[model samples]
Target: MDGLMPPPARPRPAFTDEELRTLVRPDRVHRSLYTDPGIFDLEMERLFGRAWIFVGHASQVPNPHDYITTRIGREPVIMTRDAKGAIHVLSNRCAHRGVSVCATDSGNTRHFKCPYHGWTYRSDGTLASLPQRRSYPHDRAEIESWMSLARAARVDEYRGFVFASLTEEGPDLETYLNGIRHSIDDLVDRAPDGEVAFVGGCSRYIIRANWKLQIDNGVDLHHATYTHVSTLDDDGRQFSRHGGGPRIMVDGKKSIDWEPFGVVGFPYGHGYQGRPPVETLPSGPVYEEYVRRLEARHGVDRTRQILNYDRFNSVIWPSMTFQAFGQHIRVVRPISVDRTEINVFPVALKGAPEAYNTGAIRSLAATHSAASMIQTDDIEVFERAQAGLQSGAHDWVLFAGHPGSEEPWHEGGWRGQGTSEFVSRIQYAENWISFLCGGNGNERG
Candidate 1:
């Protein structure tokens, strides 16, 4: 029995909300924010407790009582479609004794029966059955009120993507999205039917780094020239002379920087970087076919304009990032101070050519898959970052990419050259730090 149990763990002292404020400052953050377990626990309470988190798509659980289990911050929860076709997010633990109710990863069932006590719950998280009617003197109504599975504070869908927030209060999804909802719209707008679905399941991988590191990388175009050089696989010919500038593509022996390569770091810590179009995808037949369909819906000139705008990587802070041009989305889950998990889903555009979707899936496989050398290089750095930070060699990480050069974005937010730390500052320092430090979520500190 002694060998069956692990050693006792040390208790982490609680930090007052005011104390949490001191760890964050504009321009830099303490290394303990990434390396300390106590701070990690605080993040779960203050940050994850309040922010909306990305769950699986509705398509993933389309059937009655179909469900997938995932976490909100650190709480295990279930996202399921009930018999009535309504989606629900329910705590995975049993109400009776807090035992895990859903043991399997995903499946369809008429009802969830707790393995510990057989207290069953309906898909809507209503109590369905009790082992014995007379186990207690309390009426069934009283039992239901006390024992039904706990539900998420809110569940909402935008453009077929589902999200859940456990905290009862915050900005609604539309307001929280602000301008970045356009990113989701852009993905749906491309389809002739004006919809998208998650078709090619998902790839889940664990990384030994803080989730924020990956979030920072999602919009940091400055790193691509050096960190993802292997992905380009040229003599650096396609890279513009200036770092973070538009990327050039190799044509035979010559390289030319393509048009419309740009990035913008927006309010609510969201932003996008330009990537080649779905039209530029290498899957010959489908690319042309899908374009023809899009052209028919929107005129040729309009189709071309639509396809070229902000179609690359878009980061929705604290939860997920999307690559519309690539037709996949990445959702990050923080597991611990030094561990994170990411789920990548290849999206299928409704009413589009199968070839187009196939091409998107293939592209995702080549770049972000677990075996992808391009992403493997990134993982190496994420791990080394954790290791280095834990070594106590330095007290802070600096984000000084473009000093005193940030400009107001034409619409809103800030615009900087692709190399700037605008995204990092906005996400970690300005927007998210303000949330963690108790400034208004809707305003800058």
Candidate 2:
């Protein structure tokens, strides 16, 4: 009888709103936030459900009837451009039998035909037809209405980047992106044509860690000195074909002074790190030609300002993080409490020299690809942290370094020294808590 019995299912802990608030402390967060399935479920519903999550870029679906499959939280959705040249985010599930209609990652398709039932829907989510029309004894109008795919409540775009919210209520796209819009502008302005494209496709890898780990590392300037030390060469420079990344060591031994550069946090869990204290831009004929194209469009002074490269990874919280200089955008897709999928898409600056864009695409292979030395190092740390968090040895994860040192920054943000963990602190204390509590976070901590 004992051998025939199934193992008992583990009970999931549910927390009240007040209890959720207590999980996020001033300088640390409860370890359960990283390891609990119940907390992850609540986050998927309350936080990601109402937030304006990035779907994809307009450049990805440039033509009519083109679609790309992506996710908003745990729900699978399709980002499609209809024949009328309008974009829509539709639930991937079929109205009948709850089957996923579209299975491919991306392609040009006029209709999404559910393979199992032979029910088809147009790119705009309108029901086209079904195989068993005679079998349906229901009302004609109700059948049509019920058969079509459901759409995101609201969809909007800013400078070609598309974002969708599952719930109709909440701030507009511009309001949600207020403090972080400049980073998008900074990326777009780098192109001579004032546009950027997702040309290099995507490099995706799964990490056995929580999605928040990727976000925490996005603006943390202190970890590179140790976490990725192996990637540094004899001169302490990170391996890059273009040359010039943050020099972590003086003579491959002592760490460089990080006081000059800084980290900054904005409202809604957004943040960026100031450019490394090294010359990071590429040079040579390709870069010179790229500069010439930019100068031709905006003149020398504006071109210099456009290429200033003031910041590094800019994170638009809970979903996306990108680099204007690195020419790539990283999307964080959470699978579960201890699993995440990261999609790295290399960006191509429009109207820039072909060689310049080629270099950017090639650079991604050595830095962000699944087997890249740098990214693998970070993944290892994330997995290790996840394993350690499961131990129940520690109750909290600290972000207390450089306390009270974040000064007032531009556009109602805060700036701190490069090593300051204030960025993560603000995320947990302000935006993360507010979102979990169902508020549009701009709370002062």
**Which consecutive 10 residues in model 2 have the weakest lDDT in total?**
1-10
lDDT of 2 by residue, 151-227 (tens): 88889998899998877777898888877888899999999999999998799989999999999999987788888
The candidate that achieves the highest TM-score relative to the unseen native structure: 2
Over the stretch 161-245, how does candidate 1's per-residue lDDT look in tens digits?
8888766677887777777787888887878678888888788778899988888788765565556655553433322211232
Clashing pairs in 2: none
For model 2, the local distance difference test gives 0.86
Q: Any runs in candidate 1 off by more than 4 Å, and if so which?
A: 1-13, 235-261, 276-283, 309-311, 438-440
As a TM-score, model 1 comes out at: 0.88
Off by over 4 Å in 2: 1-13, 134-141
Q: How accurate is candidate 1 locally (lDDT)?
A: 0.74
Residue 40 displacement (Å), model 2: 1.0
TM-score of each: 0.88, 0.94
Model 1 / residue 423 / CA error / Å = 1.8
- lDDT values, one for every candidate: 0.74, 0.86
